[model samples]
Target: MERKHKRLATRRAAGVAGVVFAVLTAAAITLVRTALPGGGDDVTLDAGQRGGLRTALELVPFAGIAFLWFMGALREQGGRAEDRFVATVFLGSGVVFVATLFGAAAAAGTVLGDGTQDSTFGSHFAYALLTTYAMRMAAVFIIATSTIGRRLGALPRPLVAIGYLAGLTLLVAGSGVPWSEMVFPAWALLLSLNILWGRPPAAAPRTAPA
Candidate 1:
């Protein structure tokens, strides 16, 4: 009984962490997009824009930290039913996604500090790191997570399908696709909500190793 309660408590914490990770990441991305011009045209950001960028930079580190905690919680929930190969892939991709995301944010911060509209390389490079590399890793991580959830009966079939679709969209969509990156956070939001809503019962059995 004590172990069961402990497990439930852990799941609740993880679920909340996942929601926080999604919201923080989404807000940071939105702030950056709103602050910087979307096109290739070089334009100087006004005071408001600079303020937005600064806020975004500040949010990113916290988002990354929350995501790591969310990952730990997710894996704990999965327990021994998780396949070694897929679990490894999921963990690796998640870590890489966070690293690339931070790198992109740092690059963007550098560009913001320089305030050089003519030097667009940093801006372009940061977007590439985010959309191309980070999101691709995110796609893989999502797919692996969905698979694990399905195997463990942790997620519903509909949610699993949505996960697959979201992953595919992230994998196929390029940087030019407007709001494409939003799918990741949206999926995370839904998943977190579901986890919170259908929390494990206090008497539920502890997960057993395969």
Candidate 2:
């Protein structure tokens, strides 16, 4: 009974962290996109736009921290029955996503510090890292997470399907499609809501190792 209660508490914490991460990330992305559309060096930011960008950059670190908590809690929920290979992928991708997110934010901060808008490389680099590399990592994380959830019977089929679709979209079109980066946070929000309010599924029996 104590064990079950502990698990429930962990689940609640994970759900809350996931929700916080999703909201903060989405808001940061929106603010950054609005202030520095297309990451073009030719674009000049007014005082208000710079303030918004600064606010967005400040939010990134907190979002990353929440994401780490969400990832750790989800892994704990998987327990000893999780496939080692898939779990490694899930963990690796999530860590890389957070690292890249921070790197991108740092680069954007450099761009913001340049009052003359001469840091074209910083602007482009940040944009590429965020939209291309970080998003691809996020895609991998989502795919691995969905696979684990499906194997463990924790996620519904429809939600798993949506995860796959969202993962593929991020993998293939993240850099090329404008505003496609929003998909990751949107999916996170949905997953968090499900974790918080949906009925928990029974765990599937673990398969014997080959």
Candidate 3:
């Protein structure tokens, strides 16, 4: 009973954390996109846009923290059924993804702090870090998570298929693919909803002994 309660607690934590992480990351991406100059041809930032960029930067840390908690809870959800090799890849990729994301946010913050919107190199570098390295790592994380969940019978087939599709899109598109990054958050949101509301399959009843 105690073990059952613990598992339930972890599942709830994982679900909530995934939802929070997805929302925060999506919000940050939207704000950053809104604040970016048009067509890379201009480098001027209006006050509102500047404020949006700053807000996005501020939200990143909390998002990272929530993601870490989500990762922990997800691993806990796997319990004894987790494959060690896949788990290592999942954990490593997730950590790298967060680090790269933070690095990108920091890069963007530097450009904004210096009051120079015209730093083409700085902006491009930050964008590369985010859509390139960070998203690639995210793809790996998604693939590993989906594989483990499916193997453990924790995730539905539809959700697993979506994960594979999202991972492939991120891997192939990299950056500037028009709403590509949104896939990550969307996948996470769906997975979280499943964990939150969906139940495990019921076991068949055993026959009584004669």
Candidate 4:
């Protein structure tokens, strides 16, 4: 009973954290994309755009925090059945994604300061970190997570397929395509909803006495 209760608590935590992370991340990305589309060097921001950028930057840290909680809760759900190699990839990629995301936010923050040259450079740096590095890490995280879920029979085939598709999109087309980064948060939201509402895996059948 205690174990069952613990699992339920973890599931709830994962669902809540995942939803928060997805919403905050999507909002931040939208704000940033609107403020500095394509990360062009010559782009200029108006007062409203600047305010939006600031709001996006401010939301990033909290989003990162929620992501960490979401990741941790998912790992806990995997429990002892998890493969160490894939789990390592999952944890590493997630941590790196958050780090790169924070780095991008920091770079973007520099744009708010004086100097036109600094703003241009900051925007370029921010986009590079976000689209190139962070998204790639997110891709690996998604792929690894899907692999684990498949092995554990925790995720349906359709959901696993979607994870792979989204991960590949972020890996191959993220930097080349504008707004492709949204795929990561969208995948997270879907996976989180599954965890929240899907039926728990059934227990192994016990052998009858001989």
Candidate 5:
């Protein structure tokens, strides 16, 4: 009973951490899209605003990566599958996400503020967008795919469904809306549900491992 309680406590902590980081990830996405200057009035960002956006945007991907790593770790510790394939995809995309953010930050250092922008400036901006937001989107794709292939339980059914729905919605439509930023938080909510309160493991049979 005590061991079970301790396991539950650990899952709770991991869920909380995942939620916190997911919110951070969402906020950072908002910052990148809305705070930066450039593009049309629809997406305009000034030079200084871009700098600030660059700094904030750089941190978000890492937070998300950490969030995944934490959840995977927790699942492993709790005697879940650990799903090496999922972990590998998560790790690869996460690295690209984080590395690109820092790259943007580095770019911010050299590029001084100005009202107008250069064409090459657009290239760097594109890089940031592709690496950070684009790859985050990819993470959603991977998660959705794995969820479909995995063996899930009844109580957790809604979570997997929500994840698939939200991920697909974001992949298709979320990027267009100004408030598309909320997608990360939605994902975080699903992940937390799966981690903290998903179906309990069935009793182990008396037979030993084959």
Candidate 6:
């Protein structure tokens, strides 16, 4: 394999690791929820289960940070935003989006476990998770942008555009929801696309540090 191919493979591995960690975190949360010791009928959730779920969900942001670190590697190897214009736009938006997620996570994490019926740090974390999830939609942008002007040229630009628009629509929907739970299935699909079927873009040219 060529050197560029090697780099893409490496980056793909890091991304897949990030995705796998995130999915496992979600699985832990779900399992904790289901394992709540409740009888057959509709039941009150146990504090332990709720805390376990929160604890599991809390780990997810770190997974996202790890994924961003992988993306950072891709960017470090001279991944230029302008390489794919639409993707560049989304990436720029993603920079701000993830930054917000980090901030929100930090703020809520500082006051962890302080729950109120009105709005708790837990509630804020839920919102932050959904916002982070909206950030997940960026992968569609990443793949589409990265694939453009390449062999996938036959694929319509509008389709990618619409997919992103639709993702944005979903992002705006269902606020106050901790959607990190919901996106894992879709995240798995995206991860597979990157892993099983990616056509690595050309390695970005090396640059002199300013």
Question: What lDDT does the true structure give each of the candidates?
Answer: 0.83, 0.90, 0.85, 0.91, 0.55, 0.48
Candidate number that wins on lDDT, 3 or 6? 3
lDDT per residue for candidate 5 within 127-156, as digits (tens), equals 445444754555464463336334433225
Model 3: clashing residue pairs? Answer: none
Better of 4 and 6 by TM-score: 4
Structural similarity to truth (TM-score) of each candidate:
0.92, 0.94, 0.91, 0.94, 0.63, 0.54
Q: What is the lDDT of residue 35 in candidate 1?
A: 77
Candidate 6 weakest ten by summed lDDT = 35-44
The positional error of residue 121 in candidate 5, measured at the CA in angstroms, is 2.2
Residue-level lDDT of model 1, residues 1-210, one tens digit each, is 796777787788888999999999999888888877683234367888889878988999999999899999888887655789999999999999999999988878765655575347777777888888999999999999999888778888999999999999999995768678888989998998888998463232457668
Residue-by-residue lDDT tens digits, candidate 4, 1-210: 998898889988998899999999999999999988756464577899889999999999999999999999999888877889999999999999999999999999988877488778888999999999999999999999999999989889999999999999999997899999899999999999998999876433445778
Would you list the clashing residue pairs of candidate 6? Answer: none
lDDT of 6 by residue, 1-210 (tens): 697676766766655654664565456436433533221122234566556655654765765566565455434333442355654664665565456545544543333333343334444454444445544554444444335423234224554454455455455553434343344335434543554465555554466779
**Which residue pairs collide in model 1, if any?**
none
RMSD of every candidate to native, in Å, equals 2.5, 2.2, 4.5, 3.1, 4.8, 6.7
Q: Highest lDDT: which candidate?
A: 4
> 1-210 in candidate 3: lDDT tens per residue?
896787788889999999999999999988877777442224467789889989999999999999999999999777656789999999999999999999989877755654465465566777888888999999999999999988877889999999999999999998768557888999999999999999953222345778
Which regions in candidate 2 have their CA more than 4 angstroms from the true location?
A: 115-118, 203-210
Give candidate 4's total backbone clashes: 0
Q: Positional deviation of 85 in candidate 6, in angstroms?
A: 4.7
Q: How close is candidate 4 to the true structure, as a TM-score?
A: 0.94
